[model samples]
Target: MNEVFAIADEVAVFRDGAYIGLQRADSMDGDSLISMMVGRELTQLFPERDKPVGKLLMSVRDLALDGVFEGVSFDLH
Candidate 1:
């Protein structure tokens, strides 16, 4: 119930709607498909981050999680 699911082409990403950290498994499912979105993938595509902006790139990922919890829960068929 706490988990929220989102579709991204052939990938789906589950969000915590609380924490911003992409804890190991949280970033990918069992199919070896990535659980991160295009933007998240772009931000984390590489790890040569030794600059200021690069360090803060993942900072706003909270909105992705926050967007889930901030709204009213709904029912769909």
Candidate 2:
């Protein structure tokens, strides 16, 4: 996880209640960590986007909710 990498100096992996390995957080990336945890190399973590993205369906500029939020802007397709 991002938090784990951010806060941990070293990372230890356990799979099926068995200790796998330990390595420096900076020495590993998410895919490597995941591969160790799952006991296999990850080919694709996410599916490829098949459909082409459509045009923007909505837009919000300078949106605010009083004291909750301010100057928010985004576009959605």
Query: What lDDT does the true structure give each of the candidates?
Result: 0.40, 0.93
Model 2, range 1-77, lDDT digits (tens) per residue? 99999999999999999999999999999999999999887876565789998999999999999989999999999
What are the TM-scores, per candidate, against the unseen true structure?
A: 0.18, 0.56
lDDT of 2: 0.93
Residue-wise C-alpha lDDT for candidate 1, range 1-77, written one tens digit per residue:
11322432233345555333343444555333332433355436676857554333222322334645543443322
Runs of candidate 2 exceeding 4 Å displacement: 44-77
Q: Candidate 2, after superposition: displacement of residue 49 in Å? A: 13
Pairs with steric clashes in candidate 2: none
Q: State how far residue 73 of model 2 sits from its true place (Å).
A: 20
In terms of lDDT, model 1 sits at 0.40
> After TM-score superposition, what is the CA distance of residue 12 in candidate 2 from its true location, in Å?
0.5
